[model samples]
Target: MSLQDKNIAMLYYGEQPHPAHTGFADAIGADFICCNPRSDGSKIDSPLNEFFNGFSLPDYDIYITEGSRPLYSGIAATIFSDSNLIYLGGDHRLRELSLGGFPNQAQTDTRYLRTRSKILQFLCQHFIDGAIAVSADSATFLQQLFGSPSTVRTAKPYVQRDVFKSLSTLSTDLESKKVAVIASANRGNVGDYKGIDMLVDSWPDVRNHFPDLKLEIVGKGHQAKHENTEGVRVKGYVEDLDTVFESIGLYVQPSRLEVFGVSVIESMVAGVPPLVTETTGASSELKGIEPALVVDPNPESIASGIVQYFDRTVAERENIAKECREYAMSFSPDVRTKIFHEEFKSLIDEIQ
Candidate 1:
């Protein structure tokens, strides 16, 4: 599996942490190269762009476009430049454009449709071999737009070992009375999206039951200060999330919708009990994992769930924390890498 022997090219938006790990795997033994034009120099240099600026790609055995739409459009032209093409996630517009399909009259006037049409044209010219979407919903959408070749519903790949070891170093003493929520503040109003408002509303009720509770809101967002709450604190945009997780007893997410809750997995890895929404992808993954509570985004439910856990004895809490840690390891990098290898090979075979 020498890098030169594998001869694979990956197309993505940027050198994100997760995709970079996969790229590393591919580079070790396969002719693995990556292209991420959207990566601004502000974060990290675009490795693929740097390598391919003067290099060619027709020599590669496979070309994998990471996601759909805007990101995929840049790679669409390269499809024709490669021997075989596989979309990591289905491209709805590309699928439709490949088949000469057009949207309804209402959508025809929108700029989105026009841009999508151009994207589709690029994809159609490249002659895509197949697609692999991360979720069943995404797969179905791809099937409708482009027609399915082969599909696998797997959790978005993550770096589990790194996250787990970080969590292991965190203090898990329940007596610390620390509660934490890791989320993007600017995503929505504190009351609307992350359910921070719901959490705030439920605080009085929650405090009625467990007065010792202290909260740490991680991530930057526009949240107003609450004068009355005793122990609630906000540490916006933390550099070391592992250290932040150390003092927390519970991880709470009240998001209305999430493709996959990476934070929940991070929380579980850090040995923190999660109280999240059922709509979250991690909810399904964490089901039956003790102390991983699921509740609606309502104030009453969130408060009640928090109280239920607070009522648990110290030993009981420790047991639940242990279960969470064990379960989190299932998603570790080694395990996910194995899954990625198998799926990537299977997809390549099916497409070829």
Candidate 2:
């Protein structure tokens, strides 16, 4: 029943493999394969369908992939026919667990997305031997969706602490006056999910309290909405996040729905304190480190948290920054691989 001697493979349909997938592959010593299921890479069909369209799946004792399934009309049971399928469910958002059976704003926004969400709901309720969630909040959501608490396991994404962490002591002047939000601001799904508009709306109030405060909006897509916003700078997709983190005093992820905010973790690793929304999957990490930093998802609440952070003495803020770095260090790639190897062994044995 143990995976110690089993053949495992992690299949991801893209040019790049997710860091979490790569970490899991290392944990179980699985073959990590980057597969392009569709030549054109359109989202019309599930990756599973496209994967079968052009690629021949090799047999392995265990098969791992992101939690994706063919649509109701698409091919369903042909792929991974004889192997144990484990879903990496950490990367996607299921509705907020607290909103159980209730329609939230995100749920009601898009008919297309709602249909897709229903399909995933059915998959979790009926299929898959196990689901791996990266954060405790996500694990709880999967446990509910899987309807079997034991089938859900918690693991973390691999963070490149070496590249993301602080290269030197953080500067007080730089960090104290600046805050960065790194999610994409593309209109519709990308913009709405990240609550970029809300963050921008809140920036003026925060600046009103501290006139020198500046908000840096990073990531790509049309950011014209932020162009005239006072004291806000839009840096579209910088190649150097380490440099970005080094320059900021605070990081904020005002996400309406994020499975796990990777940038939030990156900022923590770089010795910058992060203020995240309660719904953010990474808030599970922040709550344990500093409860006050996890604010409600709204302009007023987010602005309040930012104001509170800037309210702290420089020495007090620096102390929190140090704690953030220390806490995030536990999730570095090497440490997580070792932890996940043991955890996955237990989880697989239980699943068998």
Candidate 3:
């Protein structure tokens, strides 16, 4: 059969479908299935019960879903053991990310989390036919830790370029010392995960060098704790980032464990140079342009990076911003969707 003739479906289990899944489905002419909870008061007690929620597995030559929990993609792999099951791997084991802090917490139970990783790893080694990860680090983890036998490839996640791109011309004059850190704290206290507190602690040191430097914290539930922090503005939840990016001189993603920092690319596309952690997936993007911008996940390193960026002459900073914007164009959803289609087609061709 021709690649175009294969039946492909993206199986997702959540309240809302991820843009990456939907974009790939559209690009490759696949069906997008949402395996969300039913209104029949069904509780997801196990992987089997997760499927009991009113949705039948649609017939398809290939099935794709996010790889992580056994409850999310495990049931599909189990049922389609003989077919081509591709998992988009992006998750990591909790212990590999950080010591006990914030979401990881001192008292958080590890039994369930560890069990889920084990089960997912088992599925990857036995049942999964192909895997694509959001970053090279994640691709390595999927092969080394998850024990996937298949060739793991790294593909960038879909990012909306037009939405986050700079609305006006990229400039160095509009407050070059102002920096913004965008992170979500909705899951729990992501302060440790995102390095928000670390960033806050670094702000004073950053201001010591550049006294006019300003920091803005943008995201849900991120402001309450840092609202009173010196020279820090907490923007709770911004509806329109177009305006926010307009004023942002520099972008920082201090995440200790980020599979792929989408916001970093978004800010870069908006003509803002970013200071990201060395381990963050998006750091790869910045390292190629300016290696000095990628810092270690610590207050001292973050503070030093911020100072170095602001110390650059305005013309040099403007050049960096331009380069960042141009490089970020390669990571857009349109570009990534095509890469996904080509990768999926190769997998389909192999099975045929």
Candidate 4:
């Protein structure tokens, strides 16, 4: 059952493969393919399988899918029919798991369909042979959901450390006063779970402490109203995070709910300190890292964290920034791939 030379497949949404799953694929070597079921018969590059949905599935030794059934629907039954299947509920979908009676939440949210949740709940509860956790917190949650907390594997989020590190440079004085937040629109919208609104609400207080403070929100669909707000700028949908991280001194991750925060790690490697919340799974690894700030997701606490950076003199800030760069070196892509590869190998070894 060792993953060496074993065929592995991962199911995901969208035309391109997701970065998170890419890490898993890299761990398993080139034999692992990213399966995109919704392709329109168009040509896709290698390592991405577009025809696996309706056609005969390749004889994969291992198969993995996200916790949601949205991608494959009834096709899941076919994929799970033979291979060693694993469910990954690591997207921090507590509400979805709650609906499934995972015991993480006492009651399901009325906003979601109880009948659908019940059906999927039964599938997750009984079908998958194993599970992969993105973090320790995710492992615990999966244990409850999979009914096998003692057996799930834990791996932290992956960081493209070298790319970001190469883009990182010492910022000029003006750039030092700038702060940035990088998250998808769905995740970082003002009032949504990402706490973008909490950061925006706290901006006035941050400005009160340091009037020259400038904050930039980089992601899709940032509201036009917020564009006019003083000392705040919104840039929608930047394809590359390297450009955003290059000039900013700090990255803020104030999410109300998150299994893992990749951008935070990306920023860290780009020579920026991150202000995160314990609510994020990445916090377990980021809590004590140099110059890292952890606080509640509320506006007051987030504002306080923002102000703390200003509290330090320029020289002190520069010193910590150097330390942060060094800290970022530990989580490079190769290191992460090696760690997960061994973890996956261990899992395969344990399997009968």
Candidate 5:
């Protein structure tokens, strides 16, 4: 179908410089629009605002909705107004909203019933066909909120090709003192869920094991305190992550829970070994890959995993790196886009 004839409009917070969000928009053949609140002097209001102000979608069948918090509010309103199907992607935070003062069974029932009534009203008004959530956890949350499990479908998170290409050139030299990277964010922020504090608390033990090991910390908010440690460096908010990935020997993601560990996949594609938590979404995909080390969030496990990599022979390390890179290629954006296209088409047909 032609872009106009397809009748799809993707409502997201805004296009990040990161490839995944923009890449998904390109793949869907939909009119992508930002619903984020415009901040004074912020560049976020530049091109997207200009485009959305003048743009209109005449014939889109779906609205691929993404983003967190207030942006979600705007997208929800749009969905209600349009009577269209919405595919919820990214982190699903709606399940966390509190239904205040609903203590008694009667009050609780009334609260939930009211919420569902509004949702159903919106769905009927907008002609919502269905919704596909990126994670099973997210789908479960939606089902709980809506009291209709049939309305929500679950899908695994996919990697974008551009991110793969960016990661593809990363060096896999284990002998080098290339530190694994973690970007800290504000508490209760998106990155907070990434478990930066877990890594921070483990830093001292990690440093004691490998004195020469360096940590490349990026992004803003509470910087990790490595006061007595020499190797830990905070490189705040780097724009060129490709360069950072190139110099890094490994990427570490110590999250307690993750819907999809895109960073791990990116690290594998970059030929950098990933030391990740077993609880992460990427762990399932990295099963049998030698370079991708799955470890507990504890400092001892993280240190041991690093030591094992260092202890390996150059040839063995290279072999592991090759395996990682090969594994990462299977999740490339093009492959994922095709899968999404086919799955979405099938869902549409099934509903029709």
Candidate 6:
């Protein structure tokens, strides 16, 4: 049988998972399983492949788990002890990314707690058959952590580009807020790291030039607590942002640290220019697409990045909007699906 015929399963966190993930698996014809308790398995057989809340791994040829550390991830490892298991990490060293890519420099958490978690996470990490890295930075970190580079391969979980591409052609109120950021609130300490506070604080600087420009912040639980600043508006979780992205002039994801930024790719597909942090995997891809301004997550840097879009004419915006859609197509799920299948095929060939 061809390597494509091999049965594979994936375990990942999240109750309401991104459809793109299951899209990747569906494209490969692999069964899907969720590690989250709240997920009610798969309701429909179409659109989403077989997603199960239970971890009864059963007879699968290969089981790939994304990011190790969650209790569910540990259960997955224990469930499929002797199978061809590949641990794919977009950012296994995610904690180390805060505070200008130096977690040790931060004073928020106890060193003992961080150290203990790191050691424990590493111990759980070391036992996997292989590590599938999704970014160059992640590959580098994985090599140093394991002292072996050969076991790692790159297979990015790219954005569902076509979804946003469909929306790019749709109509939105041109007079609406032109700049935006979407990240879930109630993330505790991580919310600040996502640049929520910095984005909020940077409004005054951004509003100085264009008095009418409003920075829209969309996500759950934050707008309730945050007051509407001079030129910043916070909205609770938005189920549908279809029309919203149509009019957005710029999409800024100035996250202090992000292993990957799907919103960047999605925004680009929506024909909006992206201003992402230099520290993220998405920023690296954005560099290839177009020099969509890379900035630090600091208030000054983010403010400056937002201001650059203010000077563009309608004609220039329209032209760049076309370019953004075309550029985003390169990172489509169809492209990544082929790469995903190859990564699995190659790994299975090596071991079996």
Among the numbered candidates, top lDDT falls to 2
Q: Locate the minimum summed-lDDT window of 10 residues in model 3.
A: 95-104
Model 1 residue 304 lDDT?
Answer: 91
How far out, in Å, is residue 152 in model 3?
1.3
**What does the lDDT come to for candidate 6?**
0.64
lDDT of 1: 0.60
What's the CA error at residue 29 for candidate 2, in Å? 2.0
Order candidates by lDDT, high to low.
Answer: 2, 3, 4, 6, 1, 5
Evaluate residue 325 in candidate 4 and report its C-alpha lDDT on the 0 to 100 scale.
68
Better of 4 and 5 by lDDT: 4
Q: Which of candidates 2 and 4 reaches a greater lDDT? A: 2
lDDT of 3 by residue, 77-132 (tens): 34644557777665544325323333323546677656766765675566666677
TM-score of every candidate: 0.67, 0.83, 0.83, 0.79, 0.70, 0.77
lDDT (0 to 1) per candidate: 0.60, 0.72, 0.70, 0.66, 0.59, 0.64
Which runs of model 5 end up more than 4 angstroms from their true locations?
1-4, 14-18, 38-60, 68-82, 92-163, 184-190, 220-230, 290-292, 298-300
Lowest lDDT 10-residue stretch of candidate 2: 69-78
lDDT of 4 by residue, 32-105 (tens): 33354335555434322333452455566666665443234314434446556665555655444464432223
Clashing pairs in 1: 1-29, 2-29, 3-30, 3-31, 6-31, 7-31, 185-221
The sequence of per-residue lDDT tens digits that candidate 5 reaches over residues 1-352 is 3333566666765444235655556666766655443434354444445334323333345666664422333334444354355545465344323222211113456668577556644643344455665555555555654456666665555566555676676555656676665554444333545666666566667667667777766566544464335666667666666776777766788765565667777777877778876655566656677533888755566667776766677677777778888877867777776666655655555555
Decide which is better by lDDT, 1 or 4.
4
